[model samples]
Structures are given as C-alpha cells and as structure tokens.
Target: MTVASKDVGMMTMIENGNEVKRTCCSSNSGCGSSEILVEYAGNEKWIQGVINTPKGVVPVVSTQLNFSDILGSWKARWGVNRMNYKINPGLYAVGTPDNESPVLVTANYKSTFDSLRKELADINTWILVLDTKGINVWCAAGKGTFGTKELLTRISCTKLHEIVTQRTLILPQLGAPGLSAHEASRQTGFQVVYGPVRAKDIKEFIRRDMTATPEMRTVKFTTYDRLVLTPIELVEAIKVSIIAFGILFLLNLIVTIPFGLDDFYAYVGALIIGCVITPVLLPWIPGRAFAWKGWLLGFIWAVVVNLINGWPQLPSYSLVRAIGYLLVLSSISSFYAMNFTGASTYTSSSGVIKEMKIAVPIIIITVSLGMLLILLNSFMGI
Candidate 1:
C-alpha cells in the first residue's frame, strides 16, 4: 500500500488554513508516521506527526452530521413545503462509513443529496460531497463546478485515498460529461465508477459491483416525473404571467370597452394554457419538439375560446377580433412552453437551439399581427 514518493505531488493548502509544506507517504500506503511543516503568513512551524497510513486522518472540519440531522434543521428553517429557494448547496455525506467504507460522491445541494441518501437507508457508505453552488447534478456538471479539477481537489483536501481501503470512487452518471475518467485515474490513484442516473437505483448498482444496465443508465422523463416539475414552473412564472396579463387586459379595455372582459379573460386563459396546462401535458401533446407541442396545445386553447365565445355568431368584425386574440394568445402560450423544454431531461442542447430558431419568429409574427389587427379594429370602430 506504499505510494511511491515520485507519485506524490506537492502538498498545498488551498483554503485559509495553515499550509502544510512537506511530502509524506501517500495516505493510502499505510505509513504510520510522517513529518508535516505548517507555514502560515510567512511564519513557519514544524510538527513531527505519527499519522496512521492507509487510514487517513479525518479532519474535524471534514466530517459532516448525518443527512437526517441536516434535514431536520432545514424543516425548522423553511417549513415542510419544498421549493428551489429553500435548498442549501454544500457537501454532504450519505450513509455511515468507517475508515474502510467505499466513498460515494455527490453534489451538496440538499434536495439532490437527500434524494441520494434517502434511497439508501440500509446501506453503509462514505459520501464525498462536492460544492455545486446550489445546482443539480446535470446542470452543475455542464457549468464545470462538478468537473474533474474540483473532484481531484476535493479528494486531495479530504485525504480520501488514506480514508478508505479501496482505491475506487463512485460518481453519478449524469456527471460523466464534466469528468474525464482516464485523467482522474491518472491524477489520483482512485478509479472512478459511474453509478446509475437516479440515486434510487444506487443500491442495485452497488450490489451489482458498480455496473449499470442500459435501463439504469438511460434517463427517462416519465409522466409522473414531468408532472412533479409543473409546480415549480408554474410557481416561478406566476409573477411574470400576472404582470403580462395585467398589461394585456388593460390594452383590451382601451381597445374595445364593450368586449374588454372577453379579451382580458381570453389573454389570461392563454397565459395559464401556455405556462400551466402545456407543461403538465407535455408528453401527450403532438410533436417531438416542445415548441410544436406547445403550439398544438395553444391551438386547442384557441378552439376552446372560439367555441365558448360563439365566434361564428358574432359580426364579421368581432369574429376577426376574436381570431386576432386567439392568435396572440396561442403564440405567447407556445413560446413560454418552448422555454420549459430546458427543464426536461430528454431535450438536448442542439434540439432546443434548433427549435428556438424556428419558433421565435413564428411567435413574433402571430402575436404582432394579432395585436395590429386589434388596434386596427379599435381605430376603425369595426
């Protein structure tokens, strides 16, 4: 278990703590004693330490309270209701582990870490948490906070190699894009093992010796999963939707005093249709692209408005006004729906960009034309 001296890199303390500037045996090598020179603010201090090699010294600061303990504090601070703003991002340890347990890595976002640990009630494992700055695994990985450099740094700082007997680290599959498996192995003696896409499947993955089948690796945005996301989307968009609705409703009142109520209600309904219903029914809607699906849902909303308002029975001028309203509503609804595609696991970056390129112009045209027609009708008193 002796790590060759040549394999050891320079020891540097990254934080505000005292710097230790001496090379010692690799913590993994089971060396019983090593000398550490502590330097801080141009002051030098030396201490001859007898550290148990292979079983690294666990810093008091590195150890974390159980996830359940943290969750209890979270509940007291932010009620029982769940929301994005309530989440705290930091490192967390999942499952109990003595010095020899396998280290499983994850982000510090409470919700994400909770999801990981809650699913592994019976297993005893060591969890190494990375600071993801409050983001989930997928997005954090894309942002580079969850990348290879950070992983290596954290491992070094924690002295993870010495803490565990096995030279293996388990990482989430979603983080693969940010990590270079080969480089990580070369830099740190720990071999990287990617686990399943969801934390719930981790037990099985561990039981199977860190191998994930195709089903476990693939991310699925099932109906239930999509629906769960709807609350956050709706809650976040509510304020904007209300302001937009108010402006549109006021414009409707100014344009047609008699039909103002109908116009206001139609626009409001469209906002809800686009931001709420469309997200909930995203999968069942027609097209592969989220924009198209939104558009289809918008069309249905327009049809509902037309049927309810008796468009055919109205004067030709009124009928034109109604069509104008419907067109604008549909466009706005569809546009917002397209934005929700970002939240989906299925939509790739390329696909979202392609859809936006085509959809933006179409939305602008429809909404602009609809608004112009309403103004024209109002001016001419049609």
Candidate 2:
C-alpha cells in the first residue's frame, strides 16, 4: 500500500509482507470503481475488491479484460483511441499470497499489465507494476524507461521489503535489456530472475523451478506476429500515399504531363502492392533485401497494367509515359517495402543501414529521371 493508501483510515496489520485492510465508508478517501466495487476498504483506494488470506489481502480483479479494454488496446495499436493507454503503477496482489509467493515485475502499460495478471488467474502471487508511462516493456526497455533506476525507485517507494520475506523478483525477459541483475540485486537486495518471453509460459517456468526451456528463450517473429504489426504501418503509409496520389492527379490535369489519370491510378495500385501485398507475401518475395523485393513486384504490376491497356499499340509518347510511371511506382514501392524492416524481425540495424546505403541513391535517381523524361515529353507537345 502507498502512503496515501494508509492515510485513508487504515492502520497496518503488519505481517511478513502482506496487506491489512479496514473499511473507509466513513471517510471520503476509499477504494472505488466505476463499475461494481466489491469492497470499500478506505486504505486500498486502488483495489476494487480483495480476498483475505492468512498472510494478507489479495486484490480481486476480473480475470478477463472487458470489451472496452480490448477495444482500447486494439485502437492503441494503431496509434489511436489514446495511444498511451495505461494504468497506475504500484504493487498489486494477484491472489492471497504468503511471503513465499512469487513476485513478478512488469511495465505499467495497461495491455502488458493486463496480459501478465490474466495469465495468473489461478496462481497466487505478488505483482510489482513499474511505471513506464504507458509504454510496453519491450519498447520501454529499449528507451530506458524500464531501466534499473526505475526498478530500484519503485522498490523503495513501495517499501517492498516490509511486505515480502523473499529476495527473488521475477522479471520479464524482454526487460533484461534495460536492467542489470547484478545492479538490481545489489541495490534492492533482491535477486532478479528473468522469466519467459511470453506471459502464457510463466506457469511452465514456475513448474520447472524458474528454469526456462530453449524454446522459451528464443524469440520468433512468425507470420501472424508480423501480420498483426502491419495495420499501423499500412494505415500511416496510406494517409501519405493518398495525399501524394491526389497531388499527382491534380498536377496532370493542370500541366498535361506525359502521365495522366491512368498512371495516377496505377501508382495507387502500386501503393497497395507495396504497403499491403509486400508485407503479407514477405517470405515468398524474391531478393534478400526488402527494396529489391518491392521493386520486382512493382515492375511486374506495371507490366500487367500496361498489357491490359494495349502495350505495343499506343499514341506517341505513350510508351515514355508508361516507362515514367513504372520508374515512379517502382521507387515508391521499394521505399514503402523497406519501411517494414524496422517493424519486423528479418533485418538487423547494420543490415538495414547497408541496404539503405545502396537503395536510397538509386531511388532518388530513378524518380528524378522519370520526372525529367515526363516533363520533356510534355514540353515537346507530344
């Protein structure tokens, strides 16, 4: 319980690291919930309800996130519906836990916190939610928001020593990047033990005495995982693509460029092929680099579009226009496809840098030459 929790009218029934509760109906400060609050112990303002145990009180929460929570999480994934969706950070008890109960640490991002807690529905444990300002553990760990300093600060603020007799803290494996076990143990006197990569595997980890299998240690970015991450990339990309396409269509009408509405529409089709199809068909796309994969698909798409429009029998400068469109579309496709490298597991930092070094100048030169050729044809009155 926090100092504020204690001030709401409860005295500590101190145990070997367990909570004591008292009713606060008489006082204004008390536990509350927008939904039904099962208990109103004045001190535990954060808990909606709790279960009493021989060692202390275990706050009761629904094992499942309601529709609202699920919807909010989904929206958050797309950077909408309040992207920083979060919950308060502090200590929470999963069930009636004794001093020997496991203590699990996690980021305060509501999605991660919810995932961690829900998986512990049948297990009695203590949860130490660290404040990461609504950022998920993996990203926060990279940003240092989930670092050792924050961990030590939270431990001190929660007075974790007074509540638990054990000296072991189970931390998520993803958070290890920001935390040093030696530093944490030295500062808090609690040995930091890295848990499995997924919360669902925690039970198996515990059953095996905190020993993780080889499978648990490996991180797999499967097709489904990559697929789920595509929506945000697609949505953000299309917003820009729409604006660019509209500008090109408007410009063609005003300037009578070699490219026309058909070309504009073709680019839109290319955008779809780049942002959506490329990601979905990543593994099958030829080439070791993402840029080449996208270019190959864009080139094929351009050919198909041209074939549908009478390839070899067209007006003067029509072939030039088609070539220009292909150049633009291929460049656009290559750029868009490469963006996914930052989101997926296929590319490392150095590899991405190397790919960019070779692809960027080519994209720029192709786009510039395509525009120059189209403008030359337009000026020639062809």
Model 2 agreement with the true structure over 125-174: per-residue lDDT tens digits: 88887778787888789889898988876666455676688899999999
Runs with alpha carbons beyond 4 Å of true place in candidate 1: 1-95, 249-261, 314-317, 378-380
Best of the candidates, TM-score: 2
Q: How do all models score by TM-score?
A: 0.75, 0.80
State candidate 1's TM-score. 0.75
Give the Å shift of residue 209 in candidate 1: 1.5
**Tens digits of per-residue lDDT for model 1 on 1-382?**
3212211234344323754333223443231122211111222111112233343322111223365546643553333433232122212233446666667788755567656766766666766766565556887798887888768766765566656778888899999888888888788788988889998899999889789999999998877776666655566566677786677666666664334566667766776676678877877776787777777777778777877777677643476677786678788788878888877888788989999899999999998998877766775665
Q: What is the lDDT for 55 in model 1?
A: 34
Clashes of each: 5, 1
Q: List the residue pairs that clash in candidate 2.
A: 17-163
